[model samples]
Target: MLSSLLTKFLLLSCVNHCALAALNGHCPPLGPVLPAPTQPSKHGAVSAAATTLKGIINKTTAAYNSSAVAIGVKSIHESGFVFSYTYTPPDKDEIGTQAVDLDTVFRIGSVSKLFAPLALLKLGISLDEPITKYVPELRALKSQAREDSPVWAVEWDDVTLGSLASHMSGIPSDLITDMAPLGNLSAYGYPAANSSELLSCSGFFGTPSCNRTAFFANFGKRPPAQVPFSAQTVYSNVAFAILSFAVETIAKQPFADYVGKEIWKRTNMARTFATQPNASLAFIPVDDIWWPADLGFEGPGGGYFSTINDLHRLGDAILKHKLLSPVRTRKWMKPVTSTSSTGVLIGQPWEILRAENVTSDGRMIELYTKRGEIISYYSTFALIPDYDLVITILVAGPGTPGEVTGASMDLMMSQVVKTLLPAVEKAGKTEAKAAYAGIYVDQRTNSTITLFLDDKDDDDNDGPGFSISRYVIRGVDVPTTDPGGTTLPASAPPALDPPMRYRLYPASATTMTRTSGSGLEQGLQQRQQISWRAVGTRSRGADEVAARDAQFAWPMYSCVTWATMDRVTFGFGARDHFVFNLEDGGRAMAVEAVGYKVRMERMSPS
Candidate 1:
């Protein structure tokens, strides 16, 4: 009973010889499949995953400035359950108006980044292989430490495909800014294309033959980018572009042809493509304004037009190990944790969400997610391997991209998962009490943050299995760097906001999320809301997880990290996560909010 959209639907019933069948087989009656709610419900029931999702869409439609969005759900056990819900944009159609549903396609930006790695993996190319082994131009280019810094030379043969995929290679963040001017830039460039304030590229949007050979040639031609190669996890759009070039160079075929045969065709993504096959593409509104730009030039990374059905097909294929081996696919989803202790990690293009006991499977479930934003569209996908569950959200804003306060995508996904598949708690584990409470201060800005576990309110829901405890935050600090090398904290001496309380729900023996709370007050990424997952330890840093029942007398899971936050706008899709540094071994030595680019030392354990 999928909303009105499930009429004559198709699901991959079996996977034999990497082939699929469409059948209406028996699926367990787990949750309610309801129609789109007129309003988004904040407190969602267990049987209302779809209803809750629709509610969220309805509430945030105006807040996020989105014109239209399509959501797809695919679950596999004995049978496959695939269904989708699409919201029609209010105004008229620019290209094909009726209302783009699961069939309508969109250029999923960095989400396309995964295809490059998958193709390489399918081609039997090892992740550890040097990228220069394929593309000779990369080997010939000089290496720079920074775009404006003195040009330094290095052996380009050292950079590997895995590093580039994981965003660990210190490639240029922007090619048009770091490299020479383009010879044949596309004329259909939108203001978002040329504006780094919005996106990374300053040249073309889609695939318009913007000269890949010449682009790679100019890499070492000038000074290097800010971060050097093999440095930390610094995001580089050019690195992905280089990966595309490498894949094409190694296969001895154009990237478009290679992916067409290798990935898309195998997944049965008929209406999908790596390039803009149609010129009269739909009007992709940014904010409320329609944005029109092609993602072709950066095809390997950003330019991919796919439909909801195709995305579900792709997810199903991955679950069935359609292209790569299970071992390879598992490795690709593993976390590449950063050294900052902020819990950030990247394996291939997927952002690893590490949590403890997030499902009933006894084993720790890791949710792999990827988010993409080009000129006109913003897309995201969350996949739970243990549950074989996948949720993909494609959004087109109907208003200004920065000004509006959209729904919290992370929270929405987390809530949907919680409602649909309630996590089994670690036996003997009680509500998380005092380990995280402390007065933490940022060293650079000399500003502080104080955490308090508050008393239960009289009017609060006290009849639950485990009573919810309020986690309060008092002081907030923000730092910014000047044009010079000196760093400056915002001059407004930070005052404590009326204590912001986020209800903490215990996931396992040691993990808690802001899933039950209202999240943060202000001054973080998007600052709209901050949904957090905290994993505490008595040791210095996060320890490796063996298995669920193996008995973690010590550390629980690996990490629950966050992506970097935006300084100017706090869109709040991803988190600006904080990590506790334990030096005394029992309590934290310091707390590092890595995504916000600040570190706070613990004064004393409360």
Candidate 2:
């Protein structure tokens, strides 16, 4: 009897998305779709717990979206526990609290990209594989380009799967050029009709006038020998769609069905779908025909949908090597390009971010995470190898700021892991850190900074090991002392207190002389000395001493020195110095500094 109910539910799900056939009202064949397993009697308890957690997330989302039309949350565990919560405004006349089941499907937007890369990997396609192997028409397009034709002059044959996946292919961000023409194109629909229509009409890529197919075909017809690639990362939605088409061609199956069978079904994901037939299933209602109709089936980028519970199952499958082998999974999680260079890698459409997790015990764990957002939906999943925990969240509605959502979710999961891992480790469990350690450049300044903890010793005298130290800023080491007056370890100074030392050595400041002496043979060398002064100030709670040290010895080295009674904060360039405020128990709350024209803002605790 339970199996019958499970089968009925799965049938309903497939009916919700499968295209209707001509003569019969019956649902399409469940070729790739997998039915949800019958729920064991024990699942009731897990469902109850999930429902409670979903309530918390819904309330939080409601509080964040005070002005938004509606909000909801769906949470799931890999064990098949599912929960969902919905909130409607009291004063506004929107839809009421209709609980959208976790199994209900919605357009996952960019999250669909995760499957694209997986499909490529599953087919044993390397990142370096030439795209033309799957899309032979590109050759014809490349051959037609003329030296004078601006669009046709470039050769795209050399572009590989890796380049497209990483957004290094130099594809235009948009295809439409004129707003007037776009008005007509707007009525076309999604996975937009043809390459020409997409290139000439779609907004996903920056080009406004060229269709994706035409763009590729033109490249084949008149290939330019060389085209300069962008130095910075360019996020292209069309590129992923094209890649998806390639996947379909290579797999010789409908892209969505192929993914469902090879990836989702293989991993036992019963609730995931690429598209939904029922518009009401959406947490936030959307026009199913928003984009060109022909493009609707494109699955190279964002398009898959699944509940939070199913996502957790997917995450578990990924970590457990149930989907791709461990080696392939590692490659997917690895940083393909510096974050600064490319806002983030174009992984299957999922944006990958590398983060550092600092444990309370002073150990730093590195994490690689993927986040997806589409219209009114947001999803984030992170696998922390060091703690052996997979955290996933899916939110529905237009509420919290995207940045805040990601940061808050990450913080919450990090805290949960921090609390749970110690006990797990005590039980003789081993944890592994993620392998995404490296230096990343900040987009603004392009300054590269390390991001992982370095512990390897390079006795061979070569460059330091890439994995040695996780990201740590030098010149600010905090010493941890153990009992018996021994130092436990050194780490980056906490931002809790103001800096204690401030030194400003003028460009002209120089050391005077150097003297080396043993008992018998001593040598003294005269050195040039630049005039300097040392100032020390101590905070006396309300009052402090401002003293100048004139008799301080000057060394041949160039330096400036200043001391404060409390702690002194240093600002770059021409900034003033200030002190930190103490909290209730005389503990410092934050570091404060004042400059001549700049005021220090308190940084939030990470």
Candidate 3:
């Protein structure tokens, strides 16, 4: 039943924009059109943007003296815009100056956690099910309350697979603890470090005792940071380690093999590995101590090594819904819990970020991202679904600290987002012009409307929606006419003195199937039903209008714009609601004014 539900959702696309309109104040009254998945389009602007990005990567990596940095960017809208850049520092040590490419492997650190949830989901494992269902040994565990310590023994029965995946299981951050690292606890009335408190066998700390038995023994001694299902997001590497045990128990095979077969193989990520492959095949940084450390049980948590090409393939597969259904993919990408920062949230394993002001319109873009650092290897993978953009950055070198790597990645990401959005928007406008921006006329009634794309890029200067230069009903200019024969109604925008404007926004989109067509077009032809809102507005000049109306021009300019905008009504429908009659390739053949009950055929551009 669950599988069928997922399948149904996968086949369906978001049909109505009204839900988004109701939920987001930033959204227009009609809401934006539901965008379909697009392959890369041919756009020169994207190429220029890629060049700018390439320069930024080269200059920044050189400045940091990065031993090796591999970056790959793919834009869904532009096929030729795929960019890849790899840098390897000059010859040093026995290995000498080895070249790096998209396929050159590097340890991905905590980024490996991203695959664990995917594997569990593929196995049809109910994420909400208690961890004890798969790993029965956890059923015997109970919490121990301590007055002085923040840690308490985890009631594993209370922890679900989802909680473990999302870092909300309240599991302790790690299983291993060093007695000497505790320092003097006598001041807090706690016992001083003793032999009993010594850090024991566990793979998390690179100890040799790396089997499941040793892991469970060490875990029982450690305590959870909080109760299960806590609202707080307390990251626990051990959570994934525990998840690996559940996976192995259910599959009756090692966790690595399962992920390799199900995810990597399916996604075409041939260069990714469950563990650090031989050093000869990987681009290991010189004198890296963490490179040689065996992860053992922690391998599921932070032990995978992947290449830029592999990460790119993974990102594409996710966005394209190659493995999971579209519904499941979207749900998995969403935030599971909020963090302290309003801009940040935590998903199953994603560090989701709300990036504001990346676009010229000042709208926020959510970035589904993950960051990893193990030893001197740093990596970041992000998916910006709004723009259908994927970014992968991998760094291997001596100076790969969290701060340094973070800043570098931030620079790359910021540049990409800022540059690509405008490029994509411009490309979209160009495409829109060819398809919808033209003169539409009702020759029987001599009515006409001319639509054009706004040239101004600044939202503050002029609101950026599809602009209308002319509108006439029955040869009567509605914008300039008084409330008699030419006027729409009182509910619509009042007749303006001069400079009247109308901006069209997408309201809804639907799909229709042919029931009674014949000949070559007889076999179930599908057409897209699209509704656009004509937001008619009356104006003098901005200064003149503000001077005339004291009440409308407020200290808070258009704060209640949603209340007034797109509310124009006729008898039963919106006065300015227009529906496009699209052909096979989404070209507008004609537009119907819903309230007016009049259809206008599109006229070819002169």
Q: Number of the top candidate by lDDT?
A: 3
Question: How high a TM-score does candidate 1 get?
Answer: 0.55
Candidate 1 local lDDT, 420-502, one digit each (tens) = 54421211111112344557775556556655433244332221112213222233322111111114436654443322122
Q: What TM-score fits each model?
A: 0.55, 0.49, 0.76
Per-residue lDDT, model 2, residue 117, is 69
Model 2, 529-575: lDDT tens digits are 22211122112111011011111232111112222221322344222
lDDT-based ranking: 3, 1, 2
For every candidate in turn, the CA RMSD to the true structure comes to 22.0, 23.9, 10.2
Predicted candidate 3 versus true structure: per-residue lDDT over 146-172, tens digit per residue: 422436567777889999999999888
Candidate 3's TM-score:
0.76
Task: Report residue 577 deviation for candidate 2 (angstroms).
Answer: 49
- lDDT winner, 2 or 3: 3
Cand. 3 Cα-lDDT:
0.68
